[model samples]
Target: MEEKKFDINTLIGFVLMGAIMFWWIYSTQPTPEEIEAEKNKTEQVKEDTTVTNPTTSEIILQAGDSVTLAKAQTELGSFAYSTTLPSAKDSETILENDLLKLVISNKGGQIKEALIKKYVTYDSLPLYMIKDNNASFNINFGTTDNRTLNTKDLFFEPSLTKKGETQILSMKLKVSNNQFLEYQYEIKPNEYMVDFNIRSQGLSNVFNSSQQINLDWNLEGFRHEKSIRYENQQTELYYEKDDENIDYLSIGGEDDAEENDVNWIAYKQHFFSSILISEQAFDNIKLKSKTLVEDEEVDTTFTKAFYLKAPLALQGGELNYNMNWYIGPNDYQILKKYDRNIKEITNLGWGIFGFINRAVFIPVFNFLKGFIGNYGIIIILLTIVVRIIMSPLVYKSYLSSAKMKVLKPEMDEIAKKYPKKEDAMKRQQETMALQSKAGVSPLSGCIPALIQAPVFFALFRFFPSNIDLRQKGFLWADDLSAYDSVFKLPFKIPFYGDHISLFPILASIAIFFYMKMTQSQQMNMQQPTQEGMPDMQKMMKMMMYLSPIMMLVFFNMYASGLSLYYFVSNLLTITIMLVIKNFILDEDKIHAKIQENKKKPKKESKFRQRLNDAMKQAQEQQAQQQKRKK
Candidate 1:
C-alpha cells in the first residue's frame, strides 16, 4: 500500500448540488391532542404488519405502535412518501458481469455483498468482497425540518434498467416519484470497476441549509489466505494524497490520520482490494484502520477493519458526485489501465527496486508465463536467465578474488611486519601501495557485487505481491504465494511456524553450500587486520552458517515462490562460481599478469595522493604528541 501526504479528493466527478425543493410535500409534527385523536381513531384497526427479517436500513414500527397514515406523515416530513414507495422487506438486486457479482440491497441502497466470480477463499468457498454485516456504505445529512437522516436508516426503492451493454441500478429515497436522494450505480459487462453517480432531483429546498454532507464507508476484510498473520502483515490501508506522491501506514497497527486532496482510497487485503477513486479533490478526510487478528488468537474469520469519512459537495441544492468502485484482485496489469495510479497499491516496492521489477523481471516473467504452464519451470528459467545476465560480474569478481589469493603470502608477511598496535595506519598505506602496484583495488570486486543488490531486492518484493502466483502450483507447493508444508508439527516453533515447509528447508541448504563455496575467496581478499579490529575471516565464516539458519527460520512462513527463487538462485550461483573458478580462471596467468604490471611505473590517483599526505600528517602529529607527553 502506497500513501501520499495530503488531503483526499472526493471520487471522480463528484459534484454535490443543493437539495431540491418540495414545499407542499412536507408538514410539521402533529400536536399531542391530534396524535391522541389519531390513536383513538386507529384503535379498531388491528396492526397486522410483521417483519420476518429486518435489515439495518429499516425503521421498523413496533407491535403496539399505530401504523396510521397521519403518524408516518408527521414523522417523515418530506420523506413520508418513502413508506408508500417501497415495502421495507429485505430485498436484493443483483448486477453481475463475467468476473464479478454484486448483490445490492434496497434497504440502504448500498451494495450489501460482492463476489469475485473467478476466485474463492482458501477453503474453497465463494470469495465475497462484501458480506453479511462486514461492510457498509452510507451517506449522512440533515433535513430542514430540524431532523438528521442517514441513508442506511431509511428504505430505498429499487429499479433496474439497461442501457445497451450497461446495467444501471437506481436506489431512491423519495419525497415523491420524481423527487428524492438517488444512489445510482452503472456497471458495464466484463469490468471490475463500476461507475457510481450520486445525485438528487427536484427536492433542493428540503435539506438543511446549515448542514454538511458526509459519506461513511467501512469494511471488515475476510480471511482469504491459509495463514492469517502472514496475510495480515501484507494487508493495510493505501491512499493517494497530494497528487502523485505515495506513502503507506505501517501494517498491524491502529492509526487515525486526516489528509487534504486525497485522490483515492484503497482498502487492501493482501491479494485483493476495494478501492474508491475520484477525479476532483475532497477535503478533511479521515482514514482509520485496525487489525482484527491477534498473534495467539483462535479466531481466523476476518483480518482487519477499515473506515473512511469525507464530506461531499452540495451544489445547486443537489448532492451530486461521479465516482468509481474498484473491487477486484491487486493484479498489476489490470490496475495499471485505470490511470488513477491505482497500480501503486500493488506492493512491488519503491524507487529503483520497483523500477527493476517493472522494467526487467515483471515484463520478462510475464512473457514467459504466457507460454509456460508450470510456474516451477518458469522460476527455474527465470533464475537461470538472471544468473546468466550477472555472469560477467561474477567472472570479474572471481578474477579479482583469484588475484588477491595469489598475493595472500605477501599480504600475510605485511601483517606480521605491522604487528604493533600503533602501526595500523602504516599497514593500510603499504597494503594500498602493493595493490596499486599490482593494478588491483579491493573495491573493484565489491562494485560488481554491489551492482547486483537491486535485482535481489527487487525479486524479494516481486514474488509475494505477484497475484499471478497466488494459486499457481509449483512442484511440491500447492500454492506458490504461501509456504509449502511437507509435515505438520504438534508443537509450534516460535519463528519457524507450526509446520515444516519444504521449500525454505531446500533454500537454506542451497544457500549454505553457495556461501561455503565463495566465502573463502572473500576471506582471502580481506585486508591485513588492524589491532582492535574485528576479524573479517571469522565474521565471514560465522555468516556462512548464520545466513542459512536465518533463512531456515525467517522464510518458513514467507511465500513458497520467493523461497523457490532463492533456492534456484543460490544453486545457480554455486554452479557459476564453480564453472568460473575451475574451468574459466587460471591463478598462474593472473600471477604472471600481476608480476608484469608491477614492472611498469605506477601513477597515483589524486585521491590516493591525498590519502598518502593525510597519513604522513597523522604520523607526524602522533610523534610530536608523544614527545610532548614525555
Candidate 2:
C-alpha cells in the first residue's frame, strides 16, 4: 500500500471544516428560552412588521374588556362610523379571472388571499401568494380629531362588479357614501396583473394636513419548494429605482436599504412573487428582508419575511395613487413583456454573462423545449451543442497542454542540471528561454479555459432560474427544479445534508475523473519551483480531491436541473479529451516540430531581455549575500 503524503494545507482544511460544522450546528440549535418563546410567538406577524399597531397582548386585553361603541369611538376617532358600514359583517369578496383569484377583505380593504389558479405547491396543495391571513397592507395617517389610525383596524363595505371580461371589486371604508377611502381592484381575464387604485373620495376636512402618510406592506413568503435552504437563497426582496437599475437585498442574512425614486418593490419567492408597482415614482422608501432560517429544517413554513415603509406620493389632501400588483410566478417570458425592467429580478446573471444567457442560451434552450417533451433529453442535447461550439477552444487548450507535455523531458533535464536551491532564478530563466524558443506561450493554455468560464457560469445561472424545469420529471427525479434524493439517511451528516441525491453524486464522480485526467497531463514534469514558492504539485493534488468533495456536499440539496447540466457537461468534456488525446494529437510529430523551431534563430523581445537582465541581477545579489554570510 502507498503511504499517504502529509500535507499541512489539507490538515488545516479539515480542521477548519470541522470547526465550521461545529459552529453551524451549535448556532442553529434553539435555546431552552427560545423554544418557550416560539411556543408563545404571535401568529399575527407583529414581530416582523414595524408598523405601529396594537400588539397581540394589547388585542387580547381589549377583547377581554367587552369594548363598546364609546370605547371604539375614542380609539378610532372620526373613522369610528365605519363599524356600522353595509358590509360590516361581510368578511371577503372575490375578484378573480381564469389565471388569478384574489379575495378582498372587508376588514382592511386589502387583499386577504391571492392564489394562482394554474399552479400548486410541491405537495399538490393550492398555491397561495397570500394566505394564513398573515399579510397586511395598511395605510397609516392621522385624523382631524387628533387620533392616529390604520386601515387594518377598520371595516370596509365591499362591492363586486363585472364589466365585459374584467372583474372588479371595490372596498370602501365609508365615513358616509359621500366621504370615504376606497380600494378598487380590477382583474382582467387571462392576466396575472391586477390594477389597483387607492383614492379617497371626498375627505378634505375629515383628514388632517398630515404629510407623513405611510404605506406599510408586510409579507412572510411561504415555502413552496422542497428544499428550504435552496429556495430561501433564491428568495429575496428586489426593487427597481425609477429611471435607474435594479437592486436587491442580500440573501444570506438580514438586509436593509433606504432607497429613493423607487419604481416597484417585489417580495420575491423562489418561484413565485408578490410585487407592488407604483404608476408614479415613490420617494423615501425603507425596505428590509429578514432571513427566517439559520438552519434549513428549523423554520420550514416560510422562506423570508419582508417589510416595507414607503411614504405614499399623495396628490391632494387624500390618497390618490394608481398601482398594479403582480402576484404570480417569476417567469422570465411573462415578466419580460412588461415595460418596466422587471425581467432583471429573475437572476440570469450580470454584464456579459447575463447577455450570453439571454442572447444565446435562452433562445437555444427554448427552441429545444418547443418540441422536446423530456427535459433530461433536452439538457443532454443542450450540452452537446455547447461542447460543439466550444470545441475549437478545447482543441487549442489541449494542443497547448500536449506541447507542454512534450517539453517535460527537457524540463526534467534542466531541473537535474540545476539541483541546488541557489540556482532557482537560473532554472526559471532557462525554462523561459526554452519555452520562447519552442514558441509555446505558457498563457496559451490559460486564455482558452478562462474564455470558456462564462459559458459554464451562464448555464449555472440558467438552470435554477429556469421556471420551465419546475416539477418536470426525468428518471428518478420527479421534480427537476428540486433535489433528486435516491436514498434517505437516518440522520443528518452535517454539511452533506440528510439525503443522497444521485444527479449530484454522478456529477461529482464525473468531476473527479475529469480532474484526474487533466492532472495526469500536468504531472509529467518532475521540476522544482522557485525557492520560496508553494509546492504546486501538492496543491493541485489536494484540489483534485477537494473540488469533487465540495461539489458533492454543495449540490446535495441544490436543483437537480443544475446537477444534471454539470453531469452532462463533464461527461462530454471527458469524451472530448479522450478523442483528442487518442486520435488527433501526434506526440512524435509535435516533438519534431518543437526541435526544428528551437533550431531556428531565436529572437529575444524587449520583455525577454528585461526579464533576463533582472534574473542576472538577482543572481549577483544572491552571490554577494552568500559571500557576506561566509
Candidate 3:
C-alpha cells in the first residue's frame, strides 16, 4: 500500500542514488593528458616527501606496502650513489703484529676485536681487550637527501698491504670508483699501538658540508681478573683535556662532559687499558660508563661498558683525522713512555699518597724485583726497607710512650687529690703541669704515628695496580694480584666472602698480636678520668679486638699482594716493639729521667700558659655558681 502511495521520503532517496551514480561515473572517466598530469603530480609529491623526511628502517616498515626501495632510491637524488645498504654476510680482516692481533670487520670498518698476545685472563684464557661485538666506532652525518647515515651500518671493502715491518689495513666505502671514505690502520711489529687514519674524498657531494660530524665510540670491558667485583671497582674511564690535570670517571659508573679540548680517552681495566690518543684534540665530548651486572654465567667475562661521543669539524670538503689506539697492559713503564699522562690510569692513591707511591714505593719495588725472582721475597724485602726508613719515627713514638708510662704514679696521686667528678678540671690542670715539668709533650706519640699513615696508604695502592704481581705465585697463593682462596664455601657470606683467603687470615692474626702488644703498653699509662672524656682504656680494648676482625673481613677479597704486605709489615712491627721493650729501652732508666726532669725548674710555654688561663677561667665560673647557690 505504501509503495502504491509513492511516499515523499522514497522519492528523495531515489533522487540521491541517481546523483551519486552520475558523480561516480564522471569522476572515473579521464582523458590521456589528465592521466599523465596526475601521475607526474603523484611522483613529484613522493619525491618531495622523501627528500624532506627520509625514511629509516623503522619508518619503512611502518609505511607497509605504500613505500618501496625503488621509490625511495628515485627520491634520494645524489645521495643514492653514496648509500651502501648493509648485507647479511659480514667479513673480517686480520691485522697482526708481534704484540697485538686486531680484527677489523667490513660491516663497520672498525676494530671488532683486539687481543694482547703476551697476556691471558686470570682463568688462563686468551686475553681479549675488545671482543664479542662489544665495541663500536661510528661516524654519523646527514646525507644530501636528509637521510641520517651512520658509517657503522654501511658495508666496506677491505684491502691489506705490508710495508717493511708495518702492516696496513684499508677499509673503503665507495660512492664511485673515484669517490670514497677510507679508514686506514697501520700496525708495527713489537708495538701495542695502532695508527688509525680516516680520509674521505668527494664526500662533500653526499654529505652536508656545513654540518659537523659526530664520532661515537663504545667499549664493553671484559673481566680478566679472578674477582669481578674487584675488577669493576678498579675499572675506570680516564681522559686528558687541554693539557691540564688528567680526569677520570668514577670506577663503578658515571657520566661526564668535557667542554675543553681532549687529547686522549682511555678505558682502563684492572691490569690493562684501551686508550685512544688524538694528535688534534677533540672538543665537546660526552662520556658515560655502566658496570655490568654480576651474572654467574658471565661475571668472569665482562666488567663494564663505556660510551664516548666526540665532534669533528670538517675542512675543505674533506674529512681527515689521525688517532692512535693503545691496547696493552697497564704497565707503568709502557704507559709512561706515551708521554700522555696515560700512566695515571693505575689507581696509585691520590695527593701525597700517590706521590709516595710514584717516588718511593714504585722505585723500590722495581729495584727489589730486579734482584729477587720470588714475589713473596720481594714483599718481605720491601717491608724491611720501609720499616728501616721509618725507624726514627718509631723510636720517637716508643720514647714518648715510655715517658708516659713512667709518669703513671705521679698522675695517680693527682687523681687521688681530686677524687670527685667536679674536680676533673683541677686534675687535668695538675696533670698538664706535671707533664710540662717532666718535658713530655702528650702529642709526641700521636704525631709520629700519624706521620707513617701516608706510607701505609701508598703501599695499599701499589700492590693491586702492580702488573708484575698479576698471576705471580706466592705461598698458598696462585695469583698475587687476586685473593688467595684456601677454601671455597658452597654458600656465600654477607660481609665475609665465599672463600677463606689464607693471606688475610694470617694478616689478621698478625694484626691482633700487634694491637695486643700496643694496648698492653698503653694500659701502663695513667688516663685521666675527666667528666666528659671518653674512656680511653675501654676504647683501646675495643680497638684491639675490633681492628683485627675488620682486617680479616675487609682484606679477604683484596689482592693477595696487599694481604701479604700487611702480614709481613705487622709481623715486623711486633718484632720491633718486642726488641724495643726488651733491649732498646729500660723502664727504670725512663723513671729516673722523669724524676731528674721534674726536679729542674721548667719555664711555661705560651700554649701551656693559655691552657692554664682557660682552666682558671672555668674554675672561676664554677666558684661563681657555688657562691650564687650559697
Residue 356 lDDT (model 1): 92
Model 3 scores worst on lDDT over the 10 consecutive residues at 56-65
The regions of model 1 sitting more than 4 angstroms off are 1-68, 296-299
Best lDDT goes to which candidate?
Answer: 2
How accurate locally, in lDDT, is each candidate? 0.84, 0.85, 0.83
Residue 264 of model 2, lDDT score:
93
Return the lDDT, model 2, position 169: 86
TM-score of each: 0.89, 0.85, 0.84
Off by over 4 Å in 3: 1-89, 159-163, 209-212, 253-260, 295-300, 621-630
Better model by lDDT, 2 or 3? 2
User: Mind giving the per-residue lDDT tens digits that candidate 3 earns over 1-630?
Assistant: 445665899989999999999999999999999999999999999876777565433332332334544443554434333333342126799999879999998777889989999999887999998788889999987776666777776657788999998999988877776777899999999888889988888887877765668999999888888977677788889898876578888774555665569988998888999899888889988888877755532355578888899987777878888988899999987777876778888879899999999999989989998978999889889999998888888788888889998898888999999988768778888989999999897788889889999998888899988999999998889999999999988888776778899998999999899888888777765466577778898898899999889989988888999998999899988888888878999989888898899999999989889989999999889878878999
Best by TM-score: 1
Worst 10 residues of 1 by lDDT: 12-21
Of candidates 2 and 1, the better by TM-score: 1
> For all the candidates, what are their Cα RMSDs to the real structure?
18.9, 22.7, 10.0
lDDT of 2 at 101: 91
lDDT, residue 213, candidate 3: 84
